[model samples]
Target chain A: MTAPNASPVQSRPLWGAGKTVVLLVGAAILWSYLGTGSNLLLPFQADGRHQVALFFSQLFPPNLSASLLTRALRGSLETLAVSIMGTLLAVLIGFPLGALSAYTVMGNRRFSEAEGSSAVARLWRRLIYDGSTLLLNFLRSVPELFWALIFIVAVGLGPFPGVLALGFHTGGVLGKLYSESLEALDSRPLEALQATGASTLKVFLFGMVPLALPQLLSYTLYRWEVNIRTAAVLGVVGAGGLGQDILVAMGLLHYQDLATFLIATLAIVIAVDFLSTFLRLRLIPS
Target chain B: MAPSIEIENLVKVFDGRVAALDSLSLQVEEGEKVALIGPSGAGKTTLFRLLNCILTPTRGTLRLQGCDVTRLSEKSLRELRARIGTIYQQHNLVPQLRVAHNVLAGKLGRLSTARALWNFWDPRPDGDVVRALTQVGIAGKYWERTAALSGGQQQRVAVARALVQNPDILLADEPVSSVDPALAQEIVSLLADLAQEGGKTLVVSLHSVELALAHFPRIVGLRGGKLYFDLPPDQITAELLSGLFTRCEAERGVPERVLRGAVSPVFPLDSPYDKA
Candidate 1:
């Protein structure tokens, strides 16, 4: 049992795909740097430092006037509502689509053929899978800001449009995450149930659903955190939230008011992040 | 009555090249108890899967009761599958779910999709789940998390799942492999007696030749996806047993315990069939 090539590891070439990837990544970074005309020292130059100091000076002494404080509070509430409602809508739209798009959720034709499923049943499964996958692709491809613009035109300007924008965009994101997690679920339990003569639907409901749920919930909570950030800025397109107030302050040169809204945005994002992280830990422990 | 299981020159090829089962033929009479013994990769599990109708053969014919499974309609195949139960070595229960729900999962074939989904959230008290748990001596852990149970107890839960299915045929694929030897003997005896009392045809694959001979009336030895010997326990000699496990131990992936078991096939003749 003596090895013919005891030092096989050392003999083998180490500079292959790993080095190629590092070279490609390095090239991409260099290309981006030149393409964007990025200047690393720009912020450290004298004029650059003065500009930065002026910006910071304006950012302080936030408007703590009672009226503006009340407005900020209202804006925060609106942003929170948009995120929660948007996420709820996303789940309603994404869950079914995600389930359909998952590779393992729909029984494959070979198994179905063995079971003697009709041609029509097979076609129906194919259609749902392909259709949902394409739909999710289209939904997520467009940015939330773009969706907000379209939604604002259709529904007129309000938080409702922002909710719709976030819903449509995040639905695609959550749908993809949901499908991947579902696809990655351990197939053993599902196969075992299928062996018991359970219908595909029965197996899915009992086996796949239970196995994938914790991961799905974890993904959804994570997506909700992302949606909060998007919702805050969705008002740039007149979709109404803390973002609209911040934009108005920026346009009017109300730096103090802008500072208050920025603080409010950060506070809300941090709050939502903490809440979702808590929920994920409590609901889906590793 | 027609044989409960019939396989005529069944061949199952994996990935177009690896023949998991090659031209293997076997028959089990109604209510007969059979144990399959072999090295790892001997196609014992593959044969069980084919019998369970979860895996279709690449060639040859397979019949359950009297119906050819290959020709059964989707609905008919499901109906046929409902009449068979399987217990795996890993006991594939959904760990996040309650034990009672996992047990009731055995009845998914009979339950409507809506009802099955509802049962997960609201597992209404079912006598069969309770009875199966009681039969396997784990009734107290019905509402407990499945993952919370010990390995041996989890195996019992798997047996409970198969039992709750109330099928006419039971396939146990190395169901007791993970447990200690004493618990393995207990589970094997439990499976044999349950099948006997219910008059269901039982087929189990075993790693230990001693357990197979001690519990089952008929022994089937598989090697390299082919049958080496099929004989009553008393008729199986040490030479034939060794041929199945030792000749190609390294190449065939025969585990050490199997070779060890082959060395000492002697066991007390306490098989229920002996009483008969």
Candidate 2:
């Protein structure tokens, strides 16, 4: 019997495969120069490898002295405090901005003649929405490190500066994420509440908040984890934390002390990550 | 008593192009129970939205409880809306909230903002809410998350919320479409009974011609965004339904067989209930 007729198969290259490879190779060359202060070719030199080996050897048998341990513990506690305060402040700042920025929550409902018909009302609503979005974009666009430096100058070097920096930067991030979550929510529930004559605030509280809360909380927790690491880095600019201790150790060429601080920072990060994960799993239903 | 709803030349054009409702006009007496029946895209939803004041008419006038809806200020419109309760096809309860919280939301319009905020935590399931839940046969689910409820039960919760609102007029937009056939009949009957017993004016848009005919005394048929017939159920004969739906063939430029095939299921010719 003759084989059943089948359409001829055609093979095509994956979309943008050649361009992606070229981009990746170019990025690698650029990144090597930026990260190593040397071109890709220089890293393969014999003397370069020996220099790396010598630098790494200095970190062996990390400082385990009682005095160093005490300093590390104090720095670790300060870092934790900075992260918690920063995250709390971020939530306080971000939640309202996010609610205001979300189109479903604050934007004029399209096709709603009462609210959307008038030119002035529409313009007012658009201005509020666009203004809030612009503010969030401005806040998040500046790096946290820059904010930390600015705060350091304003407040004088301390954990306060680190907290403020993380709070400002993370507030923007959380606001963006929160608005997205709110916008993605089902509008039917809000309509149901509105049909009952609930005011805008009431509708948001009863309808939007319930649906958006779990995801918003999840994002907050994730940001807290990120802030913990960011807070540690802020200390490099003399914003108090483990990063300050690490910076000092590196300045003094105390490689062992630097190694100890690095390990302690890693441990703290892992612990915070685990705790946040546990809380998230418990709090947000799958 | 003032009519529950009064419409004159109501028109709703979407995106300034597609006319969803075309100069429709009708009046419903206080406490009257009526069913709106139509094929898909027949302006039933637009009419319901207009009645509920969720949508403002592009043209013409709609008066509810003798008040001109188009002329009302935002504050007055809200007060008017507070007197009218609407149930959507999807239950529209916050899935993350407990059933009691969803039911309690009905009182948000009347409660002060501070009190409403306080009630979010307490959600005391006051007598009215409990009674409404009981009326819908879901009192036991008061503390359960709304998302955990099945489709029919969620619909029941929605009904309970509407009942708690205790509005003068109730509008349901395909309230039982997602429910199974048996449950659909039961829910419609429940809504009808509740509306009658409470003396609330009821306007329900339905996809099922049989359910509308079987339950409602008055049937309003709509097609191609225009009123087809407003008659007592007895006057709605099979021939009228066939004629009403078949007109779409000319408007849509679809073949006769295809139109007949699609429309037959919605307005069946040989329905056993027709003889009853």
Using lDDT as the measure, the top candidate is 1
**Worst 10-residue lDDT window, candidate 1 chain B:** B267-276
Q: Kindly report the docking quality category of candidate 2.
A: acceptable
Q: Model 2: what is its DockQ?
A: 0.33
In order, the Cα lDDT scores of the candidates are 0.84, 0.83
RMSD to native for every prediction? 6.5, 6.7
Pairing residues by index, what is the TM-score of model 1? Answer: 0.91
Worst 10 residues of 2 chain A by lDDT: A110-119
Tens-digit lDDT track of model 2 for B182-267:
98998899889988998999999887889999999999988877889999999988988986667455347532222212111112
User: Which CAPRI level is candidate 1?
Assistant: acceptable
Q: Which ten residues in a row have the lowest lDDT in candidate 1 chain A?
A: A106-115
lDDT for residue B136 in candidate 1, whole number 0-100: 86
